[model samples]
Target: MIQTVNGKIDAKDLGITMCHEHFIIDLSKVRGEDDSTLQDTKLMLKEVEKLKALGCQAVVEVTANDMGRDVIKLREISKAAGLHIIASTGFYLAPYHPKWLQESTIEDLKALFKKEITEGIEGTGIKAGIIGEVATSKNKILQTEEKVLRAAARASKELDCAVSTHCDMGTMGNEQVELMLSEGAHPDKLILGHIDLVSDILYHKGILEKGVNLAFDTIGKTKYLTDEKRADHLFALLDAGYEDHLLLSQDVSRKSYLCSYGGKGYTAVLGYFIDLLKERGISKPQLDKMLIHNPARILDRAC
Candidate 1:
């Protein structure tokens, strides 16, 4: 079964899933930019409806607790949009880590993640469906970030939940994978996000060769890399027969990326990039594995 903001559902029902996204988040505190906040529920609803129209049935909301994760708002959006929204439980990069986190041990962080995943998030009775967006810094994993990653891995292993992670600028993915697996998290259950931005096929293959999953998630953010190049790298992976280890998403975190704000928004993957992949010779079955089968397999839990 796959846990969603609404409740558990059969994995087969999670069709055309976007593996990383954010809704009703407030990153202004950490980002220090007003545009970093996405608080307008009505605007978010409109964008989500566009995604629904594009055939995206679900989204793995990877907004971490310190990144202003509002599960109550996520529940409202899930109900209003009628999209299966899987909320996350974990801390983000070092800058977003809260003050209390510095004092917390790895075991303390693990217990917190387990409680949020199994019981409820902050007593709201809306449990998180995954443990993620837990992150590492660019080219390096900070000490505090290491603690969060270790704890996330432990919680994921114990609860049998997938742990999606942030690989800043797509760097340090190998390190992230090695650390998480060393902590006993299953490689298949670990999704390293933002990998598409790196533009390194060998780096991607290196992570996949380790038996972990890779989220080619930053699909439409052209400032980092073009969709054309993203497709090329993805095609290379598929050609190498790693389709089952990949996932796709736009990682649409900022309001500037939202259609309501004149950007590609949540529909970037299903609405545009899928066609790009097809044009680059990514077959229908390979697309299905990345979009439908792979996400369902990773997100499914014993519950």
Candidate 2:
């Protein structure tokens, strides 16, 4: 079964999933930028409706506790938009981490994550369905970030939950995988995010060869990398027979990325990039594997 904000459902029921995304988040306080905040529910619902119309059934909402995670708002959006929203339980990068983290041990962090997944978050009864976007810094994993990663891995192992992660600017994926695996996380249950930003097929292939999943999640962020190049690299992986190990999403965490702000919003992958892939000779089965099959396989928890 796969846990969602509403409740657990059969994995097969999670159709056309986006592996990474954020809805109703506020990063203004941390980033000191107003555009990073996505607080308007009506505006968010408008964007989510567009995604639903484009055939998106669910989204893995990876906003961690330090990143203004509001499970209540997520539940509201999930119900209003009629989409399956999987809420996350974990910390983000060091800068965004809460004050208590420095004093916390690995066991302390692990217990908190477990409680959120199995019981509920902050006594609200809205349990987290996944253990991530637990993150590492760019080119280096900080000491506190390492503790969070190890704790997230151990919690995921204990509860049979999947872990989604943030690889800053697509760096340190291999190191993150090594640390998590060392803490007993199953490779298949681990997803390394933002790898599409790296632009190196060999780097991507190396991570996949380790038997873990890759999220080409920053789909519409043309400022970082063009969608055309993303397609080219994605096709390379699919051609190499790693189709089942890939997942796709937009990682739309900012208000500027929303259609309401003249951005592509959550539908960029389904509305735009999928066509780019199809034109690049990616077949229907390969698309299905990334969109439906791989997500279901990764998100489903063992009963």
Candidate 3:
């Protein structure tokens, strides 16, 4: 079963999921920017409704605990938008980690993550479905960040949940995979995010060689990379027979990325990019693997 904000459900029911996203979060603690906060439920629901129209039934909200995770708010948003929202449980990068986290042992961190997954987050009865967006720095995983990643991996192994991660500027994918695997995370259950920002097919191939999934998330965030370039790189992977190992999402966390705030909204990948892929001669089966089957493979937990 895949745990969602509403409760455990069959993994096959998590239809057309965006593997990485954020909603009802405040990143001001780490970003030092007020615009990073996505607090308006009314506005968020309008954007989510657009995604639903494009057949987005679920979204994995990967906002970590240190990044202003609000389970109650997530539940409210999922119910209001009629989307199956998966909450996450883990620390992010070192900077986002709480001062107390710096002192906690790996076992301490593991227990907390397990509690959130098996019990409930903060006594709210809202369990986290996934074990990440656990992250590292640009070039290396900090000692603190490594501890959290290991703990998250251990927790995921115990709970049979998937693990997602934030790859800064698309760096350290290989190292992240090594660490998670060393800590007993199955490669198929691991997803490395923001890979589209790298633009290096070899860098992506290196990570894929480790048997992990790659999230071409951050779609429509043209300031970092264009969707055309993203599509080009994605086609290379599909051509190389890695379609089953790919996932898609927008990772829209800011007000500027939301349609209600004059941005593209959550429908960019399903609404716009899929059409771009078809124009590029991507067949229907390949598109289905990327959009539906790939996410299902990575996110479907054995119940």
Best of the candidates, lDDT: 2
- Which pairs, if any, clash in model 2? none
At residue 59, give the lDDT of candidate 2: 94
Candidate 2 residues 1-303, lDDT tens each? 988999898999999999999997778887899888887788889999999999999999999988888999999999999999999999999988888899999999999999999899999998899998999999999999999999999998898889999999999999999999999999999999999999999999999999999999999999999999999898889889899899999999888888988889998899989988888788899999999999999889864
* Candidate 1 to truth, TM: 0.98
Off by over 4 Å in 2: none
Alpha-carbon TM-score of each model against the true structure: 0.98, 0.98, 0.97
* Per-residue accuracy of model 1 over 47-101 as CA lDDT, tens digit each: 9999999999999999999888898889899998899999999999998898899
lDDT of each: 0.91, 0.92, 0.88
The residue-level lDDT of candidate 2 at 221 comes to 94
Q: What is the lDDT of candidate 2?
A: 0.92
Q: Model 1 Cα displacement at 95 (Å)?
A: 1.4
- Give the poorly placed runs of model 1, Cα more than 4 Å off: none
Model 3 Cα lDDT, one tens digit per residue, 268-290: 89989999999999998888777
Candidate 2: C-alpha RMSD to true structure equals: 0.9
How much lDDT does candidate 3 score? 0.88
